[model samples]
Target: MAFQQGLSGLNSSSKALDVISNNVANASTVGFKNSGTVFADAYASSLTGAVSKIQIGIGSAVQAVRQAFTQGNVTTTSNPLDMAINGNGFFEIELQNGGYALSRNGQFDINKEGYIVTSLGDRLMGYQAIDPVSGDVYAPATASVDTFRPLIVPASGVGAIETSEISLNLNLSADAEVIPTPAPPAAAIDPSDPLTYTYSTGIPIFDSLGKEHTLSFYFVRRSDVVDTTTAPPTYSEWDAYTVVDNDTSTLTHNSTIGFDGVGRVAAVTPHVTAGVTPPTNGSVFSALLGTDAVNPNVSTLGLNAITQFGGESKPRELKQDGAPPGEISGLSISRNGIIQARYSNGDTKDVGIVNLTTVRNNNGLSPIGNNYWVETPESGGFARGTPGNGMNGVISAGQVEESNVDLTQELVQMIIQQRNYQANAQSIRTQDQILQTLVNLR
Candidate 1:
């Protein structure tokens, strides 16, 4: 009986040592959780066989090996492939062979087929991204595949030079001084002539093929015929502005804009070019400016940051309802985990939202190797939602969650388990000695 109990004690201590060693070995693994070995004493019962509370010898057995749920520290890395979960959630991945797996490790990679799959080639699942124009999922309806590659927006598409709107600002200084008018039927004028004052600027415009066309705007202040009765303080409200594309001039007259006294531009007349008539109602104008203050449009125009769209599309009635031609200024992560993209055209838009998911029983998930777990009937159904929604926590970019194993704690437990194993071995030795003495006496 003593020998049997001693053997049982040895086996139990061995199992505890195994658990401790495993904990220590995986201390550096990402997302690893340490497990503890539990033990219980086994006893036997008999009916009325001198049953006077006789104490049974030590009979130990391992009861359970439970995982710890303590949180792990997060570290930042430069790799976009590395990911981390801030709180209660796991990333869903699918095997190429059609089975699904779950993991807390967010480290991922792209497959050879341009798919954004895990390092192990498992596909990451997500709500299929929808097309903005067609309102579809982009792929064919018959396709069942749901994973997708990280989308890389082209630097030249609607994002590159989206010409939604255009604005211009200018201050025409009227001196009220008398100037000579051009003679009748005179188209060509001398450059050095005092009668002509040229106002020119280069505006970057896109052609029909999306190629840049530097439209040089020349506003030659053509003098108006003044009556002898009017004094030097009188000035004409109409200012002639010509828009040219090199010597092959597109427009050689004033745009649809009109000016008032005190150098304030009131409205713009739609500009018309060869064989193309400007829309009657779709003309564009800037915010009205007073001489006391400098308008931002004028300031921005001077910096060459403002874009001028020169397309010939029949214009819809102009409004501030659409996006402007914006350049990629920069990007930022929002408080709600949405990516916001800013453009040079003074416009901002939502790019994408970060998502998260949680499970009712993480341990119950089937471990299919490669740090991946699969959903099973025992593991309750998945709860899918956005981050910061319900039990799901907010997202933190550029950070990764480390393994939960505590090295100091594991080392301490290792020492205790080692001592316990030695004691168990001594018990076995003592038991053998006692049996040897009994045999010697016999």
Candidate 2:
């Protein structure tokens, strides 16, 4: 009986060593969790056998082997193909037969059909739920599970061009010389005009047909000073005009400037040149303001000097409603997982948000091929939502998570398992020797 018990002990220990070795072997495998084996002591029931002087202890038997799903360290790699889970979640995958699968391996590839697929050519699964209100799939109900696809650039899209936001950083020096203000003194030029200021704005605009056009804005300041104090001064108010023209049809805005009580230019009105018409070919295109007037309605008087002019010809200002060309320049990712694209036409629009998922029982997942796992009934269904939602992790761009294996820990476990194997072998040898002695005595 002692020999039998010792042999069982040796067998159980050997199983434990096998479990440890497997853990060590997969130490570098991505999303791999180390497993541990549990052992249970074996015993004979007294009711089943005749009573004995001493009830000898029995050896151990291998019980269960469980996996550990602790968090892994996230590392960055140049290839956007490499991905990692930041927090409590696994990427859900769809099997070839329509059964759902899950995995922590984020490495992905694009398929021939333009579908974002796993390297194994499995089409990524995304949610396409029906909308409650309309009783149909909501707008853009599908979401891609794989993230390693290249961003697609759209050739064109709907919606009219708008100049909602404009920022300017420019210089209007006092030493600026004028281009001999266009004919007839566009309102008798101000005599006090110390110097004339000139500036230009270049706008790359596009026609309604998507043809590229360049609209250059030129500003020639007649005079900055407006002496409304002179009781409707003899000269028309000194005004700033913006001329819009490309290589084609010349269009001019020579709108006159309105003055207040202090001879200061107040509001401005822009008008296209008498013979020329506003470009109907381009979409809401470019509008450039080169004059010192920072605000559309207000003009500087004291800090910036101008002459007080009164006459028939007034300076023409560019209409604020002109159309400009648009170009996609770059993209950005927000903390909330929203991705946005920037346009060269000085416009920004929202594109899409990132989705993330988590599981209730990660350890219960079944390990499938290609480093992926399939969800079993034991593992609760996915807790799906956007990134940073609930227990999900924050979304990071241009970064990925790395395998969590620690070489030092594996080496130590290796040593411990080896020692256990040796001890178990010695136990079997001793048991065998004892049995041999009994046989000799017989």
Top candidate by lDDT: 1
RMSD, candidate 2, Å: 9.3
lDDT value for candidate 1?
A: 0.53
For residues 182-206, could you state the per-residue lDDT of candidate 1 as single tens digits?
6778653333343553444445544
User: Cα deviation of 28 in candidate 1 (Å)?
Assistant: 2.0
lDDT (Cα, tens digit) per residue for candidate 2, span 126-244: 33333356432211333455332222323333233333222222333333333456466363232224243244455443333333344454445454344546544422332343323
**Position 14, candidate 1: lDDT:** 90
TM-score of each: 0.66, 0.67
Clashes of 1: 4
- Model 1 reaches what TM-score against the true structure? 0.66
